[model samples]
Target: MSNRSYSSQPKSVVIVGAGIIGATLGYHISRRAGMTVTLLERDLPGAGASGHSFAWVNGFGKDPRAYHTLNRRSLDMWYRLAHQLDADIGIHYGGEMRWENDPRRATQLRQRVRQIQTWGYPCRLITRAEMLALEPHLHPGDVLAASLSEADIHVETDTFIDVCLRRACEAGAVVYSQTAVTGFVVRDGSIAAVKTVDAEFPCDVVVLASGVQTTELASLAQVQIPQQQSPGIVMKTTPCVEVLHNVAVIHAPAIDEKHQHLHLRQLSDGSLRIGQGTQEGINRDDSQQQADALLDRARAYLPTIGDARAIPTPVGYRPMPLDGFPVLGFTEAVPNLYVALMHSGVTLAPLVGEMATLEIVDDVRVDWFASYRPERFSVRSSG
Candidate 1:
């Protein structure tokens, strides 16, 4: 959208990784008249980050203003899609609860609620008594209190992804599974096509929603992607007679190493997702040492969680982004190339799809030209 303007005409687009972002983008693109779409993934859709997400759809943990707005937009789409595709997706308005014990933090929490409200997010500050009355099983800590944000809703991630893929197919998009894109055929100022191991898929545009593996994927495409990895570890416990009914969390993740926070949510089938530990590191799979460390951390909150699971799962996702927010829009350098990625993929996937749809399908021009342009890294190389 710089010197080159876009016309509101449909075009052929190729998307990489059929996760939430990719699938949604593919679906939306295919829906537009005169548009053709192709989706490529190394595995079946939703088998990667989208499948293993915490799925705790909340705006509290997100950055206020832009991020919170983005989350809410995605959330609205998530709910709408659930009902629109109810047979294939189940959406639950599981209230998200966050509390703080520190006096200073309690005040700050209330201020945050006000900030969120001012920004149009529905939120309310509740007293300890009110909170306990709503969720009685919570440990009555001797300090501040909790804030109930009804905006948070838990959804079946895999199911929604599958339904989205089906929608994409119904809309006439071709999806290629187990296809690893190795290169981008760049001709003139635009991406002409992408090279996969088995064949070449040509398109007028390519939307890059490669998720955590964006760095490597960008490398193959000869594009410099500004990103980093924020590793997360999550575990699930065998169902109890109901240790907790609603999802509860301590509200702050960066308190201290000794402060292990638990975000517990009950799945549809009565299984409970117990999560607390997140750190920075790389591990393709789980290990004995990681399990032991996770257990010790889980014990710090509810000792029974890790003890019940025995071998807790080691969850991992590198919430990749350029700065603190998502990297989006078409690259200034590569005319037909676009990038979209961030931490709350489940919560923000719909919005990402919408924005990308605006750019690729509707031909709406958005200039990240310098600020959010995906090829900013390439500009540095030229410098």
Candidate 2:
């Protein structure tokens, strides 16, 4: 760890990745007074984990009161952000509906609902009749217990990322796609510029929001940001008739013991994004057979998905920290090198963007991120 004084207000800021977190942070930082923002992406915007995420914006599965509250705050911030963005932003906001079929899971669902309610989450148990009323198209086999997190919603990450980058560009920020960060130009224990394949971008701060590649990129700056392997797959379907009537997303129970739970959400274009198991579930099977099986199981719940074939998508690797929480704030090894790595990028984009801007532009350490600093990671010598 090194101590180097940084400008209270940084003018040249270089963001390493243009995913949801980087895009949102770019937009926020560009809006600040006298800030020149540059977003660097190796691929097209939203081409990484953000584009393939389940995109369920919620605090339901978050444990610990503080983390749950953090997610809950971001969950509500989406509404304000949508209004502020003043564009499509691809927000479907009818809330998330989930049900459990087995008796054991049903009991657990009820308990979980009660637990979040104590934390003041806008969720409650509802009767099966109410579930049908919300989504009449659902042919749920047996709903032993059901709950609705009224504030939860799903986002079309492509649309959101596009809108954010456009806004950032409009605010005089430059975005370079197909640009990979090759290294960092360090001088006097701080990053003086970020080196890409094409050119070096002079900067006062560098944000590592490069998803699964964050660890390796941070290593270039000699900052230790440990990450675990977390590969996931969320298959897509061809356009079909609108299935979900009122709810933004649905978590359907597994049909049998062989399969895991299924979650789905429909896009404005009438196509559905389907995935099995939990949000953090490990799945790398991108074969057509696996895609077809997921769609078939979805058809069992909503028959309106008629003739909609599944489109196999490549497996996406989430930027999951070893501890399974976010790693935010500037690193002690490099004071100006900020790290913004997290798993639930979709859910926490708005909060991370706005709050990270506060730290990056205003030069203040946000207390909300006090528990999630890069210093928590025990640095290992770079290879």
Candidate 3:
């Protein structure tokens, strides 16, 4: 959209959604010379999917070598981004620890560790003693196989998002909270301006990073980006003594046949966020009973988690593409309209922010996003 032939370098860029992706992208674009950046959000930052995410930053579960590599690259880039920000970005750097109680799962875990290792992932199988050494308080019962992915970490999404938005604002970007996107002003085939509830932002380019609502917003421009329903819940707990001392995240084995594995991480405030099944697991129950059950399960391994009560959080709907990969880049029907929607927003924020800035401000198409182009979804006829 900022091509040399198409008017001088997209002087104005309007970004919809102030979530992690939008905040990161806004921060990056605002720093670019001669670009006026504006971020529009219907609610406060991190109030959407980013707020309720497990916030684990890892590539261990990403399948296919290319996808795994994408996550791995971003996971490493976080360190550099934090250094560049030069502020406390709520990044916990203890890596991830997990163990298997069943022989079948142990074999699967062993195979998975080897598979990722071949791709240069910093992960390996560990002995029971090594597991205990990494986490002394963990009472992992009957560990058949254990692992320590030394590169994995989790984030406090709220803290990181707040910091990013503050930095973006400091760099001359205007963030409009409580401003909902009404529609788009299209000229020829490109978005000329983004319309909000009470105002309209004239821009050369518009980006939709509105999480689960991306599909609906993009449709106003006649761009069809389909997404699957991916509602998940991550229950929070009252602040208590720090349970995770060495690791930022821990995946505990399921206690019985009906239950799934549990993953949890402690926030900087000493509150613990626990989730069941998998990162992509579907859970709609935000009832107090469900929260209590999850907290009780967490207590099974970390018995020292004394008096930390569970707090029910609403289910978060992930912006999952039908194929389960990110959908990035501009659309065929709307060249100046960029869509940044994905499930692993926290894991991919750094990479997407930097590379998308290149694609947007510098007008260069990135090869890394070739597989995730928006044209992959058939665009509906504008007529």
Candidate 4:
């Protein structure tokens, strides 16, 4: 860690992207006394994965102590952020319940539950009777084992982005909507200005928080940040009478290769948000077909959603790194350029913003972020 203190003089910082990560970073950094922040969005805020995310904020499946620890920390940070912003952000801490159908997989699931519990995660196995008692609407069909963790949170991501942006704007951060970063002007091996379609904005530092487009923007600065553009489809239903008991149900995929994993949760407005695995070559017709299929599967578990209609929504790409973890912190090739890209943007947004701001404004290196540096990918490319 570097022993650097916060600068007294204000730094002109430009952030490219107005998604949840960028917006939250702006909000946190702008709260400091000596920072001039500007957030640029090609589209409106939350127009990317943040908008379409299933938005379940939990560290249930994240592995490696460092990654899971960060997520666990962010889970607490979300409540604090919501309190500070005085906004609802649609956060529900009703917890999550997951079960396995196959008897063999149920044994593995029990082992996995023990592993996570040993790691200090709040998860425990429950019988089918207990699972049904917790969520009375669930149809427990041969569920050999199930786990429930009350530490999970559900969010309405678009509202969260809006609240973060609003607070950042209140703190004097300038926001530019529909303005895209076309290129970068580098000087003395450092970013000097961000070139947009209409004009160039001089900045002391540039933070690239763009999701799938992070790779394209980094290339302009001669930095390679590779990302896997995984396509995910989320199906929303028209508002109906509440049938779900406010608990999220996440089921293991069928072993026979005939059923896709199903994750279902209820929104604040009595509508159901159901999602499944990524469909690589999904087209318009295919999207509807997939949505119908997911709904049919959902009906098997929650019979109330059978009458609900599927609303048409565009699919969003998850900005997953090549290794399926986050790529955060500064780049070695470009000293003044920082990148924040990850798959669970919604779950990790607030904490990343707070930590990234500390590193950027105070020049302090966070020891935990050492593993996620962009240099990891650089080493991969050279090898």
Candidate 5:
């Protein structure tokens, strides 16, 4: 709306993707004074990994550092937005039960509790009996000990942004769907316009958040960003008549199926979500068969999950930066261009959006994001 087209708002913004992170960033930053937001999406909102996701607002699983800090901040912001937007992200923050195998693992979980508490997040240690009481279907043999952090939420990314994006549009942002940004028009070192198959949208600033496709857009801006894809899949069951109320994750190493880490969670609609396994490669193919094997194996970890009404397999590619940690903020080489890419997106989306919004619109330092600059690898190479 203002003539200052050099930021997320105030300046016209052409966001390349409309996933959760991009939409949230657009939604939050568009509400600022003196700004216009123009969101460009290759597909419908939440269609990408944002839509096909585990949607766990997991503050407990992140490593204990800036990753944890960023995730925790995002969790706080999500709860705030749950109230502010009054939209459904299927936010259930009751708590997650992390199952343990033995005293040693239980001790390790105690350490996790100690670590989070040391950072000022409270968590409760529960016994096997307590866990069974919470998630009755959990195999008593599979779970030895557990940790329950009542701070986080379980979410469904599919419909999470319907309201936020709608609110963003209502508040003056223009979202172009099914219209991909073929490329960008760069003048000098700043972005001049965003080109698509339809029309050229001239803008002062551009945010590249096209998920796994970010590398392509980065190339358009003349930045050789190295982003890799990691595949992890989750299976969902049709709504259960008595789906357990809380999230349940087993910690024991021993399992009935081939050895791997496994997790179990009950969706608000009474469906069960199960995830386990990490596959790293450039796989464009959906590993439905491979995931089915894992899900079959996962049923043994939690027997009740196999009593499915219907099993829907979902595949996800975690965008692991060659340098672990997300890539965010403006490039040291290009002006008016910002990026947001992450492997653990839902955990980092809210913070990345809020912080990146803080960086792009307000010209703030974004010191918290020092760990995630894409240029750092290039700088390190030259150094």
Candidate 6:
């Protein structure tokens, strides 16, 4: 923790991207004294990946104890943030239910469960009987093992983003929709203003939270933030009778195969959000076919989506780092420019927002984010 204090003068901040990460940061920063914040979005808030996210808030399957701890901390923060936002962001702490069919994969999952348990995470392998008790709707077809984690939570991603943006505006942060960042004004090796297609917004600091487009935006400042983006499809079905009681179910894919898994969760409005865990890039021609396949899989798992129409929703690129972790913190070469980009943006939003505000407003560097600094990718040249 650094003891440096920020200047007493108000800092003008220009946040590029009005997604959940940027919106949350803007909300926190605007609440502080001596700060003027502006959030710029090419479209409306949550119009990017935030709108299309499966939005399962969980720390499970995250590697490196430090990263998992950070996600868990954010999970804890969500409880307070939901109430503080004073809106029904559709936060359901209904936990997550996951299972594997293959014998080898079952062993791997059990080992992971043990590892997470040692880390004090609330996860445990359950017997088939227990699994059925937890989710009677699931068709337990040759499930080798199953695990239940009460710590997991899911949310309505779009609504949550809306709440974050609304709160940010209420806290005095100005938001500009349909304004795209075209370039950056660099003065003495620091960003002086963010140039948009419509106008230039001068600011003392600029934060890049533009999801998959972060790498592109960072280049305007000659900074590198590498990303491995993959197009993902999320299908939402018309409202139906409740099929799942409380838990979101994830069917793990077999070993050696990347694309053939399904994750389904029920929204508060009785709609099912189904995600095809396959990385089959975007196929405009085959989108309806893909959506049909996802709905078929959901029906196979839980016979509840009977005769329901599936709408191919969101379909955005996941903003993942090249190394499969988050790229956060400020760039060393461009000290005034900060970035917050990650795949699990939904799970990490609140905590990242709070910590980022501390770093930007109070000048207190969070030691935990040392590994996730944007400088990590700056060392490598963009291909």
List, in order, the clash count of every candidate structure. 0, 0, 0, 0, 5, 0
Q: Which stretches of candidate 3 lie over 4 Å from their true place?
A: 1-5, 379-383
lDDT of 4 by residue, 1-383 (tens): 43222232439889999988999999998999878899999998889878877888888877777788999899879888889989788787768888887777789889888887988888899888888788787776778788888788888887878888888899899999999999998887888899999999998778999999999999999998897658777788887766667565455455356665677777878787887653232323336667777777888777876588878767778888888888888787887888999988788987899999988887878876888899887744554
Q: Write the residue-wise lDDT of candidate 3 on 323-354 in tens digits.
A: 89999997777888889999898999999999
How well does each candidate superpose onto the true structure, as a TM-score? 0.84, 0.98, 0.97, 0.92, 0.87, 0.91
Over 4 Å off in model 1, which ranges?
1-10, 86-88, 239-257, 277-311, 366-371, 375-378, 381-383
* Ranking of predictions according to TM-score: 2, 3, 4, 6, 5, 1
The residue pairs in collision within model 4 are: none
Between candidates 2 and 6, name the one with more favorable lDDT: 2
295 Cα displacement, candidate 4 (Å)? 0.7
Relative to the true structure, candidate 3 reaches a TM of 0.97
Candidate 6 wrong stretches, greater than 4 Å: 1-10, 252-259, 278-286, 380-383
Model 6 Cα shift for residue 75 (angstroms): 1.7
Model 1: which residue pairs collide?
Answer: none
Ranking the candidates on lDDT from highest down gives 2, 3, 4, 6, 5, 1
Root-mean-square deviation of every model: 3.7, 1.7, 1.6, 2.9, 3.7, 3.1
Q: Give the worst 10-residue stretch by lDDT in candidate 6.
A: 1-10
Question: Model 5, 1-383: lDDT tens per residue?
Answer: 22233543436777888988888888888888777899999889888877666666766757747678778888778777778777675676666667666667667778888888788675778887787677776565655557777776667676667777888888899998899889877777677889999799887778888888888788877786786666666666676554454653333344544555555566667776766642232334345565566556656556666456436465666666766578887777676778888876876777787778878787776788877777775544454
lDDT of 6 by residue, 1-383 (tens): 43222243438999999888998898889988878899999998888988887888887877789989999999889988887888888787768888888888789889999999999899989888887787787775777889998878888877887878888888888999999999998887888889987688988778998998999999888888887757777788888888777676465453336446678888878888877553334423227777887787778777877887788665578888888788887777877888899988889998999998888877657887888888777565587
lDDT of 3 at 235: 93
Higher-lDDT candidate among 3 and 6? 3
Candidate 6 is scored at a TM of: 0.91
